[model samples]
Each structure stands twice: as structure tokens, then as C-alpha cells.
Target: MKYLKPWRSDGGGLLHLTILLSLAGLRLDLDLDLCLLLPPPTLLRDELLLGCDPTSPAYALSPYPAPGGWGRADQLHPKGREADPAAPPEGQLLREVRALGVPFIPRTRVDAWLVHRVAAGDADGAHGLLGAAAASSAGGVGAGVDGGSQAAPGGGGDPRASPSSPLAARQEEKAPAEQTARVPDADGRASEENEVLRERHEAVDHSSQHEENEQRVSAQEEKSLQQKNEDENKTADKPDWEAEKTTESRNERHLNGTDTSFSMEDLFQLLSSSQPENSVEGISLGDIPALPGSSNDGMNSSAHYNVNFSQAISHDVNLHEAMLLCPDNTFRRDPVVRTSQPQEPFLQLNSHTTNAEQSLPVANLTAFLPFVDNQMRNLTSEDFLHDLNINIFDEINLMSLATGDLDAMEVSQLFQEPDSDSGLSLNSSHNSTSITKSNTSHSICEEGATGYSSDPESLPHHNLEGAVGGNYPAPMGHRSDSGFCGDLAFQHVFHNHTYHLEPRALESNSESFSWPEKPEKMSRYLSDTERNLSRDERRAKALRIPFSVDEIVRMPVDSFNSMLSRHYLTDLQVSLIRDIRRRGKNKVAAQNCRRRKMDIILNLEEDVCNLQAKKETLKRERAQCNKAINIMKQKLHHLYHDVFSRLRDDEGRPVNPNQYALQYSHDGSVLIVPKELVTSGHKKENRKRKREGIEDGFH
Candidate 1:
């Protein structure tokens, strides 16, 4: 398995999971399907039966021998000295199929997939499918036992079967003599026993060649079979009698001779020869055990299995052609012939096919999509509240941050346990008038490593928090990002205004205070509305203005005048009220002005970006058009020269391209004009340019 480290600052590793099983000592291979690469199936199709027994060439290319078995990825031995001298070069092959450098099985995915197939097991189908194919040969070997057995136990493609060194032959000749001596045959019958063994060995050697002929095949036969299938597909309605006769003659010769390109149909013929019995062979998935839902009843059973080509071709027009995907991802007219060890089924890629997706031209889907306009997006005070999405309830115990309406609270509690009865709270509201009149500014820098940070605010609490003492606990929850809106607070900053509700102002509500006009409920109203009052609210209250801030700010000019006439306020009170109303209106107007200014700037930026992208696209298109125009002009020049050279004017002389020009008439005819006319047109354009220049100078 391959691993790539995380490319993020937060350290972590991406993991791939794979299971390596030793179930029943079978090495399983999974067949990959083209459709599985797309979305629909969600997994590989189970019908593409897996190949078995690793190919000799497949292992010869591996970097190192796999430690466990054939399916595992090779790993280097921890120690240098641990090496197997007898291991063949074929033990270390690393083979994989790929398309345009993309491995069919991603290197990062689990090595093999088979977990979803079998029940009451580790559920890898690699071996189950392998066993099913072997079941065919096993049945053949069982029935053919009477005919005579010749296959060696180590299986086909074993290096030991090949003829090699004379020294190995000498050892083989002397091995029985040594064995007989070790066995202590006191009856002295070793010579007679050796002769009997020699005769039996000779018969066994001769028998294997004939047996191997039944399965072994040459590539030419596979090629002919594919061609025959293609020819049949092309001539479905009108059969090619000559080609059919040729294929039949070739097949008869192949069966009569030694060479064979193993076909499933042939294998079943040699196994269960009856036509009706072989009909069920492929439908049974190479004799693999039936799944619970699959019907085991012979005829009905095939309804659950895919049609097996090995047992049931039935002269279908293009059935063989449907077996393999072509380069264009469509099925070809003939299946690719694959080869394997006579004892073990294996797989190979068809040398013929090419991938369709790689070859086809594709268009960009999003090229024509329209751009979005985000210029008018707004940041409201409600927007600021929702930015945090904070639910500030009495029970929640959230810190009031100092960045805005909420405290980016540098400190939640200002004092530690000085006394059980004493405590301190951090609040930044400007409502208190006399506790500490030191006006402080809070930082709104809003830029840093976390995309947010603040410079210190000039607060009286900083001095007091030192006089008192406390440390902080770890912060809770995700940090909320709120970009400071400095525009709304500009009026207060510019005017150096502080809106404070003084305790002495509310003292008028106490019974001891004199209210010569009437004993009115003043403090009750103030208490209920105090928390939500605006800066204008505080100013109106300080001046003892008789209306709410909203009424003062929103009242029309005529209505405001009527309100003033109704109230018998002093000159100082009236002036203060007018100043308050003017400042409030101007403040709102300024904020709108600023918001609109920023919006216009943002819209201009977006416009510039879109126009720049369009400019680049147009530049490329213009270059392409210019190239096309030049090519067309060159062609037209050649055509014009050829036409002029072939033309004769009145005296049977050829016309010259440089001296004459052709112009089309309105009535579908061509006329020749002298080259001097082109020169006159050019002179006229020069005069027009000069005239335009003189006109611009006068302007």
C-alpha cells in the first residue's frame, strides 16, 4: 500500500485499509471492469470471474519476492542476509494494468476487493472463483483416470518440468539406488523392483504429452477464432460460405493435430461431452457453489446465473463480439483470447483495444455560465449579532467580547476571591455615568494568524484588573469572525460623545425629590427602556427632551415643528434637541454614503476581473481568427494567380495578378480593374486621415 503525508499544518495521515487472507491456501485475483470506474455499480461486477495462479512473467518483473503469498505487495527484508538461493527470478514480478498512467486499481486503495461475495467466511471470492474453474479440470481428471494419468503434482509452469542439467539427471538416476539401500531390502529384490519402476515411469512420461495436448493451444488459432466471429457478425444475414468452410477445415486440422488454443467449449467437451450436459456448464459459473437464493435445480438454476458462453452460444449473430470492450469502450465483434497454465486459469490484456475516454474530445461544461453579482451585500447590526449566532441567555455564561456589542472579553471576571461576598464583572456598555468617567477606545484591528486579533483598548478596567487579580480559564466554543464596522461608530468617535445614564438623573423618581408639576412615574419607564436606548436616547434624556430617540430622528420637518410648538421647552433644551436631530440624521446619511461607496468600489473590482478574463479569452480567439484569415488569404492568392494565368483578354494573352484586380458585379459577374485604382483608394484613405486630424485639432 502507498501512503502520502498530510499537506496541512494540522498533522494527520491518510490511511488505506486492506485485508490479506490465507483462507484455504488459495491465492485470489479480482478482475477489474470498465463500468466500475464510473458511479452506477458502486463496485466491480461479480460476473468477470477472477484469474488464478500467478503468471511466471507476472512475477519475474517484481522488485522483490512477496513475503506471504502472490496477492501481497512486496516488501524489502529487514536483514540483508536473509535470501532464498533456490528462488527463481520469476518470484519477484510486479505487474499492474493501467490507462494513461492511472492504475486500474488505485495504488492507495486496498490491494484486492472480494469481501461482499461469500457468507460465513472472510468472504474473499478470489479463491472461490479459482476453485470453481479448477472444479472443471478436477471433474475431467476424475473421469479421465481410466484413460491414464500423466500430470505431475507440483502443477503446470513449474520450472522443474523443463529439461535441464545432466548433473540433475545423474542425481535423479542415483536417487532410487540410495533409497533402496536406506530401506534395507534383505530379500535382494531391488533390481527387479527398479525395472518395474522404470517401465511405469516411461509410460507416465509418454502419457503426459498426449494429456497436455488436450489443453495447450497456439496464438494463431485464437486469432482465427476471433476473425471468424467478426466475419460472422459482419455477414450475419448473408452468411460467408467460403469463410465458414475455411474455419471448419482449420478447426478439424487443429483437433486432428497437436496444437490447441484452449477454449472453454473444448474443455467442457473433453470433460462432460454430451451436448445437453455441457449446455449447463457456463451457466453454473464454473461449478462454483450456488448462493442461497440461486436455484440449484439444473434448468431453472441458469435464470439466476449469467449466460455462460462456454456452454451456450446457440449460433447467436454477435455473442462472441459482446465478450470484450474495444478501445472506444464499446464491445468488439470478437473476444480477446487469453492463455494460462494448464493447471491454473490466468488473465491478460488484449493487445488490440484502446480506451475511448482517452481518445474522445470533451467540451468544458461551465464555460458559458454567467457570473454572480455580490456588490450590494450588506453588514447590519443584526448581521453582526447573527455573525456569532450566539444565544446570549442568563444561564449560558458566555463572555461578552470587547470587539463590538459583545466583549472580545480580554477578561471575563476582573477580580479573584478577595472576599466571599465581593465579586467583579466585565461589562463595556457606556450607560454608567459616574463610576469611572475615563473614556476608553476598544481595538477593531481584525487581522492576524487566526484571521482575527485586536490591539489593546484604553480601559479603566485594565488598571483595576491589576489592582484586583485574576487569571483565565481555557476559552470555549469556536471563535466567531466579525469584521468591525467602523462607519456606524464614526459619529461618536468624531464628536467625542459619551452617552451615560447618571444615577442623579433617576433620583428625580424618588419621593424625596421635588417634582412641583406632578408626582409622575419617571424611573419605571426609564428602567424598562434603559438597556436598549441608543446614543441619541442618552442625549435626549440628559437634556430632558420629552420624546423617544426614534421619534426625534424619524420625525418629518413639519411634524417636528409641531412637536416643538406643543412642548414649552427652554431655549437651551430646544437647541439641544435640534442639534440631536440634525446629528442623528447626518450620522445615518454618512453610514449609507460609506456603505454605498464601498459597494461601488467592490462592484468596480468585480467588473474589472470579469472584463480582464473576457479580454484574455478574446485575445486568444482573435489570434485564432487571424491565423485562419491568413491561411484563407494565402489560398485565395494561389487561386487568384491560377485564374489570372489561365485567362486571356481579347488578344489571347494571359493576364497578370499584380497589374489587374477582380471585383464582383452586383449582377453575378466579375470585372477587372487596373492596379492604379487600388493605389487611388489608398491615397484617398491617407487624405481622409489628415482631414480627421485637422478636424480634431480645431476641436
Candidate 2:
């Protein structure tokens, strides 16, 4: 009777399936050694056991306590079983234990795990191993329970009697034998009651069996899922591995490029064979096929196959041999002469010849003089030697002048016209050709001279000077061992000429020439400003800044703006504001002003809050005082009523005010505020406020 409701009613069929699904999804991958217990087994077990009343002593000894009756009164202890406020039902406890044990029930666990892996497509043996471990453990515990159950049915039956005592006989005599009797003549009422009890027990047992079945089915489903996972993993790995291998093979093919049967070693031999045996250093020739439309007759083919040995020997060939493998003339064949003169037959300065051109340095004129000689020697062979001699002397003067040789003037004067026929040949049919030749020759002569822009009249009059100054004339009043070259050359020319004149040649022969003093100065046609600038440059001093108020006033506004902007004072508005404000109030005072503004806004909000709080506090105080006053009034009224009732002659009536004075405590202190003072304070505060307002208007 103490069992109240059957245990099976507390559990449900869906419980097992829900637990199994949760177990499968849970992140806690329980190790075999940790066992099938919840994280905090004590807490969980106790919490889950709620309402089971395990703490009750009688219930603890026997879950279904002996039927409460008068006969068992002597056996019952004075302190009955204390019911536990928290205790789970028998079915829930059994299910929880099984949920924990499911992973350890060896045989079933191994089977489930293997099947799960297969269903889940996980080929790895990990799942099966873990499942087997759990299954074996649970199976052992379950087997132990089964063995004990077989050893003793109903636990020796009848929980009411002490099993070992001979007093049991007496207890049996008192036991309700009619409860077990199967008589057919029993009343329908009794029989129906029995049937009802039997049905309830059978229904509970059936529900428990259903729960067990659900757990078994859930385990089977999990096994299938695990197995499916294994299979899928195995299948996925196969294509990935094969794809990796295929990619590697394709990469190998791309790098080798071995479509043809020819090997790299054979190709190397053929390439080497195409080049000549005597090929120079740094030369490499590739195997070149024959050109299209080329004559490949025996003689021509022989020429194509052969190397130009003489041409190769004449120069150090730095070019690759692959270049020579092409058709004839595809590669250049000119000799690169690094140390010799040009082949134009011009006399060289380094040569040991007394000839004028041979004695002169060729460095300056060599670049320009080659073409004239080439053309002159090639045309009109009859005067070639004589013309060559005359041209050689002319080239010497040009070369000497080009190189700034000390003997340039002498050479130039020597080669100067013995007659008017001294200049370039004018009778040539090719004016353009002659002009080109003349320009080149003259250019060389001009570059070689001391001054490229020298005046012809000033040449003979020029005196010795340091060559560092670019001016061509030598300074006067100085004597050298050989005299200045220009002066010497001038004297030689003068003495050799047919015309003789006095020492002061210009004065005696005014018809021939005249000269002016201050010859070194530049032409007088120079402007005054230009002359003044040159004279000022000749002196060394810093120039003073030319300042004028008008110039400053005329300065562009853009220039002034640019200067202002660089200094970050560009905005006119900013400047105007700065000018007006000049110095702001002290920092502290400014800060205080800003603070006051913020405080006013914030204080406005705070004032409303404080006022509300004050109102609430006042309301609360008023309510408390009112409640106290009402309570006191009620007490006073009762006191007055009691006093009046005691003092009256039999009729109920009001009491004397002196006899029933109001009494109360406020804030833990006695207060005695008379009604008159309270009323007067209120009236005075109102009158004072009204008078102050009237006085402010009068002021």
C-alpha cells in the first residue's frame, strides 16, 4: 500500500530512444575505464530518485513495506520510515542504470557497435573496439543480477516475517491465507478486486518490457549509423588517392616532353657534330637545316658545310656558333680591330714618318678625316700620289689644330696657300659631295685649333698666353725659347713672302693693314647693360637686395596667399576671429563656464529625479505616519472606549479628552506636536512666501 502508484507508470516508451540519440550526439566520448555513470553520479542519482522516498527507514528495508495493519503493529518501529522528498521511481532508476550500463553490456554492445560502424560507413575498427568494451562490462553486471535472481525467487517471499525465526510459524498462522486462495465460489466483489490488482501488475510489467525493447532497437539503429559512416570514408579516400597519383603522372609528362623516340643524349651529339672542330672559345653552333630555295649542288653544299676558318682566325669571336649555322651571309664577317688604325691609308701620328700628317696626333681628326681620303684616292688615279702628299700636309695642320698641338700654327701656316689654288677643289662635278667633304675636313681643323671660333685676321697678331683660358690669342710681353708658335709662323711667312716692309709694318703699309689699340676688348657694339653685368661678374661680392615699397606693394596677391597658407593662417575668417578675440578668458574660467553649461543640463535632469525621490520619500513617510496614526488612533479609540465603558454607568458614550490623550512613538522617539502648532506653521509658511513675492514686485 505504501508503493501507492505502480513504478511502470513513471517511465515512457520514447525514453530509451531519446537517451540513445542523445548519447550518440553527446560530445563526451566516454572512455571504457570511466564506466557508465553520469558526470556527477551522486547528484544525478539523488535528483533522479525524487519522490521515491528512499530515505524512509521502512521503505529502505523493503520498497513495498509490509501491508499496514493492526497485526503488524508490534513489528513496526516507533519511528516510521521517513520519506525522502527527492526520490525517483523504480522504472526510472532501472532505466537510468541501464542507460549507464548499455555501453558496457559486452555481447550486445559489440554487436551494436559493429553494426553501427557498418551503417555509418566507418571502416575503422575504433568504433567496434569501444563498443565491445562497453558491452562486455554491462553484460557482466547484468549476468550477475540474473544469477542472483535465479538463486532466490521473490527474495524468499513475504516481506512481513523474519526468515530465520521459529516465530515465523506464528506469523504464517496469522497471515492472510484467503488472499492466496483460488476458490471459484468467492464473491464477485472480491474476485473483481483481485482481477484489478492482477491487471495493474501485468500492465506495469508490460510497460517495463516495452521500455527494454525500445532500448534494444535504439542500439541497433546506432550500430547501423556507425557502419554507414565507415563505408563512406573508405569510398571517399579511394578517389582522392587516385586523383593525387594521376596529377603527379601528368606533371611528369609535362616536364619531360618525350613524345618522339629521340633521347636528350643523342640530340646533344648531333648538335655537337654540326659545329666545327676548331671552333674558338665561347662559340657554340646549333644544328641548322638547309634554307629554302638554296642551291645545294656539290660545290655549294661543300661551301655551306665548311667553316670560314680564315675569318674565324682573324678575330676573337665572342658570338655563339648557333649564329653561323644559318645561310651564307646571315652572320656578319667584319674583323673587329681593337689596336690598329683605320684602313683608309691616312698617315698615323705613331708612325715614324717625317711627313706632316705622320708627325701630327691623329686622335682628334681620325674620326672626321677618313671619308675624304677614301673618296679622293678612289677617284682620278693619275694625281693620286701627288694629291695624297698635298692632302697629307693639309690633314697634318687639321689634326694638329684639332688636338691643340703647340706646332699647330706652324703647320697651318706651312700648308697655307702658296697660291689661290690652295683651297678645296671647286671643279668637281658633285657639288654635294664636295661640300660634304669640305665640311668634314674643316670641322676636324676647327676642333684641332686652340679656339674653334678664332678670327682669321687675329691669328698672326695673337701672342702667347696660358692655354687654360679658352681665348685663342697668346698674351704679349713674354718671350719663349722658340717664340710663340703663331708669332713664329707669322714671321716665317712674312720673311718668305716677296713683299718686304718696314719694322712697323702696319704704319708703313697702311694700304695693306691697320690695327687698333685695346684689341683684347670685346666689340664696342655690346650694350651698356650687358657690359656692366660682365664687369660686375668679374668682381667678387654678394649683391644687395634691391628693395622698394612700390615693388612690395606690386607683389601678386597669390604670392602673399601662398606664404600665408603654408603657415596655416590662410582662412580670412580665422584671421578675423583671432584679431577680434585676441586673448580669451583664462583657461580655468573658460572651463568653469563649459562645466556650468553641462551641469545646468545635467542638474536639470537630476533636479527632476531628486524632486521625484523627495516626493516619494515624503509620500512613504506620510503613508507610514498615517498608518501609525491610524493604528494609534484605533488604540486610542479602544482605550477611550474601554475607559468610557469602565467609567460609564451602563450606557456607551464618548470619553473625556484629558482622560484619553493620544500617545505614539515616532522614529523611536516620543513626539508631542500640538494641533495648534502644526496648523500655525502651515499658515505662517504660506503667509511668508506670499509677502516675499509682493516685496520683490515693489523693489
Candidate 3:
């Protein structure tokens, strides 16, 4: 029996060729659309049983030309040898042959050479059924032959003597004559002859000349085909550079007409040119067209149109000027004149018109027309100055009173003006006296004169006598009378309360007016810091707490206790103080807890977001792992089928999976046993273990 030489020196001999052919057959079977259209298990089982069974009819007759003859005449009786009349049956002979371990010819090499010859002879028909069946069954038949060969010595018998050798050609020429001379046996046992005779013939014809010639021809054909395919692939892969360049040039030409760059000056010029000719800068009041409702019959229509047009033109001009002057480009229009009294109708159609009709003003006309240039020119500087001073004085008085409380010193400082030698200073003293008297009378009436004595006996014989009589005394200084008037005015402004002025207004006035250098005596008249206090603070102040309201509420427990010990406070005072402290702490704690709760909620939201992202990532990973597992399972299934299909019994028959099952041992060796036997053996083992456990329990 010839043993399979898997590690052959000459390019891995017949065993390697068998494996390659088996792999090629598997690839072709897998590629068939029939596998997708049919159930996978059923299709795979049919293909494996049909293709891998060496005894199948498809593989019974070797595709290669036998050296002896087509019917094995020479193998049965070599050189006119007589046949035995009492020869055993074909099955018995096969069993006997296998038992004896006789070597056979290397049919794998012969089949491969036959396929090559057929392919060379008729290239167009090379893919026919005969070629396909031989390729598919090559591995299984080779494995059987290898097993038989291993049972006998010199299995392959020769290194050379391939099918393409001249010796094989000579045998082919004599095959026809031998076939004619040979007679068929009635029992059909001729085909059952031992393959030992063919092996002997192959061993005798081990020559190398014809094999070398065939190898050289086949190598030249393969090299030329490969080189041609590579050249074709290179041409197909190359890009058309010339066409691409032409396309790019065409696109460039299309874009050449448009300019993409522009300066800021160009944008400004374009915007200016886009403006209308009748813009506000070019149009005047005279240019405005009269409305269709205006009449030429009376001066009233003309006057009304003039008023409306002037108002419109003035509004447009003001907006245009503001846009050009202001950095923010915002327009601040003048306030419109509003009147409480009713006016005559623009067109008094009749003298008997009702008062309601006469009172209705024109829809689009201004309530008062703008003053003419002549009227404005008639206004003197003194009149303007006087009006300006009165407005300033009113604003100061209002601002001082807005806080409803003002200290005596703050009020005095507010009205004090800077020393200047202008003629306006002379009249300031006389005007200041009247202003102080009026403001003092108003403050006394409104605020109940708590800081001053209204009695004539307490009044001082001075210009500010009515203003700060008992509350504040006028400061004595070398400053002008304007300074003294300012001091008197401020005393009346603040009265006996604390007042806060706008910081901006205070700063502007401070630059012009200087405060009295000696204001120490004024401090006694100013109210205590308890002014504008909350009810609790006022009550605490009235009770005369030694510590301030802030210290009482915010001090630590030990400090508060020490403060109480030092003060000798009543029980009522102590209880009230403790209540104030507790309320303040609770308010602060509530604010902190609200902030902390919001932070915790935000952190939990962030955590939820992160966990959701992680869940998505895990879902994606699980999907990928499942896909990989399915792919691996498919490959493992194919590998299992391939291995099982290669298994054979001692009689050289393919093992049937229905009767026998393949199992793995603990040592990792594969063992084939009948299905029923495996199940019975497992059952017996389980029963024995159970019985042993019971006996151990009893013991």
C-alpha cells in the first residue's frame, strides 16, 4: 500500500495537489447561487455525500486512461495469462485486496495529467461534467488510495514515470489490441482485479524525458497567460489625465469673467450712488408738496400746510444730522409741543360751527409752529440766562427732595456754589434769600418741621432765619454771598432728613460749588444713621441696644452672649434679639440650600447624559460582536462538514453521520462511535455514578 507523502521534495506531490483541488471545489460549491436559493444544511449535505464518497458511481471509473486497457484486460491477465474460473466475487475480492494491503497506481497524478491533456486538446470543452467530477472527488479518492498505499511497501513506486511519459504512450497504443483479444467474464469480475499489476507497470516505466518536455511546455503557457493578464489590469487601472486637464481648463474659462475682490471705497461709492435725489439733505420745507385736501381759497389752508410741511422737514433734517454726528448712529428727536387748551379749526367753514368741531385739530399739523429766525433773534442773553438759572435751581431742589430724607450737612453742601467774581453773583444773594424762604416754608408744611422751632422767639435775625433757625446755623466764611446763599438753599433742601443725590449730578455741581470748610457744628443737627431703617432696626434703635443692628443679627453665639452680659439687656430685648438672629440665619441657610439643590440636579442630568452615551456605545459593540460570532459560526460549520466528509471506515467506505457521531475526548482526540452506543454509554455512566453516590450516603 502506498503511503501519502504530504511533504514531497518536488512541489508537494499528489497529496498537495489533492488538497488544492479540494479547496478549489469547496470555493466553487460555495460560490454557486444554488446554495443561497436552497436550504443551507440540505444543500451542503447533498454536495458532501455526492462529491466526497470515493465509491460513488461518478468516481468508480477513473477519468484517466488506464495503461493496461479501458476494461482492465491487461491487469486481469498479463501477457496472455489465463484467468481463474473460480475467482471470488467483486466485493469479496475488494475486501481481500484491502486486507492484503496491496499498493495501487498513483491515480491522483494520472487523473491530473488526463485533465491537463483534455484541457490542452479541447480548451472550449474543458469545463464539462467529466472534468468537474474528477476535480471535486480528487481529495477523497486520493485519501483512500493513500490509506491503501500505507499498508504496502513502495506505494508510489517511482519518482518519475508520469502519465505524459512515452512509456504511457506505448501502453496506450497497445490498449486497443489487448481489448480485442480479451473476453469479458460472465460474473463481471474483470474490473475487480487488484491494482498491483498497474503499479508494477508504472514502476517499470520510470523515465524522466517526456515529463520534462511536458513541464516546460506547461510553464511557458502559464507565464504568458499571467503576463497578459497583468498588462490588461494595468491599462484598466490607469486614469485619463488628458481628459481631466481639459475639463479643468474649461471650468477656469467659465469663471474668468467674474471679479471676486472689492475695496471698502467701492462699497461706499455703490451705497452713496444708490440713494435717491430727494433725500433729506437735498430737500427743504418749501420742497414738500401740498396735500390734495389743502385749499387756495383761504390763508388758513396755506398756514396749516406750512406748519405740517415744516414739522416733517424739521424731523427729517434732525434725523439726518443725528446720523452723521452720533457715533452710534441713533436719532434723538426734540419733544413735540402739547397744549391743554383747544384751538380753532384750520378751515372755519362757517362762524356757527360747534365748539367740538372747532376744537378738533388738523390730523397732520403741529400743535405750535416753530419760531421764526426774527423771533429767535429778538431774545436777549439776560433773559436766556435767567431762564437757565431758574431751571437749574428747580432741578436741584427736586433731586434733593426725591430721597424724602436728607442730613443737614448734606443739604448745606448741595446748595453751596463755587466763589466767582461774575456779576451774576451779586443778584444770587438776593435771589437765594427768596429761594430759601420759599423752600423752607414748603419743607415745613410737608415734613412737619420736626428739626426746627416755628416760634418767632427761636428764629435768628438773618437772611436764612426762616430756613435753618433752630436746626442749622449759617456758616461764617470770607466767601462771596453766593456761597452763603448755596448753604442756606441746601439747609432748606435736606431739612432734618438724609437725602441721596444722583452721583453724576453731585460730581458736576461739586466742581462749581465748594462745601463750607467748617461743617462740624452741622453734624449735631443732622439726623442719626437710623434714618431710612427697617421697622426692626428702628425698634432696636428706639430700645437703645448697645450694639448696632447688624452686629446683633450677625454675631456668633458666644459673642452675642458676651455682648448681652456686658449690656444688661431686659428679657424682652434679649428675646427679640435672639429672634432677629435666628431669622437672619434661616434666610441665609434657605438661599444656600436652594443653590446646592440646583447644583445636585444639574450634576444628575449630566450623569444621565453620560450613561445614555455609554449605553449607545455598548449597544453598538454588542451588535458588532453578534455579527462576528455569526460569521465565525458559519466558518466553523463549513470546517466541521469538511472534516466529517473526509472520514472513512476500515472497509474504505465513507462514514454515515446518521449512524455514527463524532465526539471529542478530554485529551482532544476525535473518536467516532455509533449514536445509540454513545447515548447508552452516557446513560450507564450516569446510572453508575448515581448508585455510587447512594451507597456512599448509606455508608
Candidate with the greatest lDDT versus the true structure? 3
Q: Report the candidate with higher TM-score, 2 versus 3.
A: 3
Model 1: per-residue Cα lDDT at residue 681: 70
- Give the per-residue lDDT of model 3 (tens digit) for 368-486: 11111111122212222122122222233233231112232232222222221110121233233322433243332121211122111111111122121111111111222222222
lDDT of 3: 0.29
Q: For candidate 2, give the lDDT.
A: 0.25
Q: Global lDDT of each model?
A: 0.26, 0.25, 0.29
Task: Report per-prediction Cα RMSD to one decimal.
Answer: 45.7, 59.6, 65.1
Per residue, candidate 2 scores C-alpha lDDT tens digits across 1-699 of: 101111111111011111111112211111100111111112222211223333332122111112231112112111221111122223343344334332211111112222233223442332222222211111111111122122123322222222333223322343345334533221112222222122222222222323333333323322322233342333334454343333233222322334332322222233234432212111110011111112432112222223332222111111111111011112222112111111100111111122233222323223222332332233223221232222222222222221222233333332342211111111122223322333233333221221111121122111111111111111121222111222222222211110111122212121111011223432332234323432112110001112122222344557544533433221111222222222222334677889999999999999999999999999999999999999999997887567545553226564454443333455576333455665676699789999999999999
lDDT of 1 by residue, 230-308 (tens): 5444433333454444434433343234335444334434334422322223322322222211234221222323444
* TM-score for each predicted model, relative to the true structure: 0.21, 0.13, 0.22
TM-score: model 3 vs. ground truth: 0.22
Error of 1 at 698 (Å): 12
Better candidate number, 1 or 2, judged by TM-score: 1
